[model samples]
Target: MASFVIEGGHRLQGEIHPQGAKNEALQILCAVLLTPEKVTISNIPNIIDVNKLIFILGELGVKVHKIDESTYTFQADDIDLDYLESEKFKKDGSSLRGSIMIVGPLLARFGRGYIPRPGGDKIGRRRLDTHFEGFISLGAKFRYNKEERFYGVEAEQLHGTDMLLDEASVTGTANIIMAAVLAKGTTRIYNAACEPYIQQLSKMINSMGGNISGVGSNLLIIEGVESLGGCEHRVLPDMIEIGSWIGMAAMTKSELTIKDVSWNDLGQIPRVFQKLGINLERKGDDIYIPSQEEYEVQNYIDGSILTVADAPWPGFTPDLLSIVLVIATQAKGSVLIHQKMFESRLFFVDKLIDMGAKVILCDPHRATIIGLNHQSNLKATTMVSPDIRAGISLLIAALSAEGTSTIHNIEQIDRGYQNIVERLQAVGAKIKRVD
Candidate 1:
């Protein structure tokens, strides 16, 4: 295991480029299995989860070649369909949640797909019912192997049908779209997830000869295609990382510029930070945050205390709520953070409270933070990273605290953010990774 020893109270300056979107990379990588032709992808984030997915593809006999540091070409011309039933595959596929997405493309092209019980951050109950249910709706036979804790889907030939998802589950929507693109008839998906990742996946599939309409809306229509061809795709910048940097600049009173942030796709993220009084300037495609002595949280129009909550896309992302909560510790006013999507994600506030932040854990899903208003610095402490988002949030808190802080189990952070220690160091953050 490794840890990050960070010296606090240093202001970071200069420009930092956000890595490619981690979530979108997962979807795009899985989509490669849908086509036999070489699909070149640029801006691939070199992170643990993505690498693990690539490793899984290699195990399945997909041809993967590295074109550059952030580019790769994948061809599924010689896939080993039987490899999905192997014991090694069960172990490898269970390592990341994104591995479950492969079932869609595999079932679409090969008529069968298998997956072990997937593993990821234990934030809350992330259900796979929506995914399997979508496959079932697309004329696939779904079965669960209780002994192996695996899921299997098979169809001689998938016939498209209408499906109204129980929720706008991102992975579920991606899985259904991948499967529907090759079905025999038209597939209509209502209440689908329309996040930037989903939109980009649709565009990439369309470019590869699939017909998908309503790329940026909840209703998606996919016409079955005989086969898809090769295409190049460049993923958008990581919005979660952009939001985290914004929070970091506000908490530490630093002047930082996040480059190539895909500003239009950021939706309400910037406005959400602005409500906390953080100053942001848009320079073409980049976001510049000026140094701040203090920032004040804004109240509602009716004079009630302000509340920041997570919703589906077009609202505040649940992924950045942890960062927002940590940033609020230094703001001038109080705000309630509701993590409506995940129950256990807000429990990390106990550690923040231990570090001198005034936080009331209303429940597993909500927290109310009373800002210090720069009155005092947070005292450093030893802590463990419970999950990816919480781990980065604690790292941010440690950077803005007094004295040195040690965060253990940072492998969780590496699973998402690429070269975090090195990237932060480039901007003058005093952090070191230790074995």
Candidate 2:
């Protein structure tokens, strides 16, 4: 295992170009199973999760070729669907939650889908009931053996139907969309997750001849198609990464400009940060973060303490709550951090507390952060990362601390951010990756 060692309190000042969306890349990669033609995707981030998905695709006998830097071509012309039941496949497949997405495509094209429980962040109870419910709604029969923790779905003739998802689960919605794209009739999915990642997937599907409407909204209508032909598409820049950089520059009082941020696609992230009193300058498509001595967190209109919460797409992203909470520690006022998505996400605040952050853990999902206003710089400390966002949060917290801060379990960080240390270093952050 590797760890990040950081000598904190260095103000970062530079320009950074966010990488392609990791979430979008993973979802798009699985779409290859829906076609036999060659699909070329550009601007793919070299991250752990994407690599694992590509590895799983290889196990399924999909021909994956690296054309050049940041480009890969996938062809599912010769697939081995039987490998879904292999021990090696199941073990590796269980390592990522995104692996569950393969079920929809596999079942639609191969008549069956099988895999053990998928794994990713241990933030909370990520349920697949919605995924199975969507499949069952599409006339697929599901069998789950709890003792073995394996799931199998089969539908003799998969037909599209109208469904209101039990919940707007990101991956569940994605799985359902993949299944619906190849079904018999038009599928109307209400209350769907139309996050930027999901919208990107929908666009990719549409480019392949699938008819999809209402993208970037909760309502999605998909018209089933007989076959999909491969198409080349470039991925959008990662908004989450851009948000992370915003938080990073805000915390360090650093002057930073992020290029190619796709300002139009950043649905409400800018406004959400504005509520936190973070000033961002948009010149063309670039976002500039001017250096500031201190910024106060704005309370609600009533002057009561504010609360920053997460919701589905067009709402604030739950994935960013961790980073927001950490950034709040340096602001001028107190705020409640409500993480509605996961139960265990707020537990890591204890580590932040140890580094001089004044936080009250309300429960597994909520915390209150009282800002220090840079009055007292946190002392460097050693900590272990809990999840992807939490890991990056801790790293950012470490960078603002006074002395040396060591963070273990960097694999979690690498799973999302591409060359984060290098990028941070480019901006004058004293961070290094060490084993």
In the range 275-322, model 2's lDDT, one tens digit per residue, is 788999999999999998887888888899989999988889988899
Top model number, TM-score: 1
Clashing pairs in 1: none
List the global CA lDDT of all models.
Answer: 0.95, 0.90
Which parts of model 1 are misplaced by more than 4 Å? none
Off by over 4 Å in 2: none
lDDT of 1: 0.95
Worst 10-residue lDDT window, candidate 2: 81-90
Residues forming the 10-long window of minimal summed lDDT in candidate 1: 308-317
Model 2 deviation from native, Cα RMSD in Å: 1.0
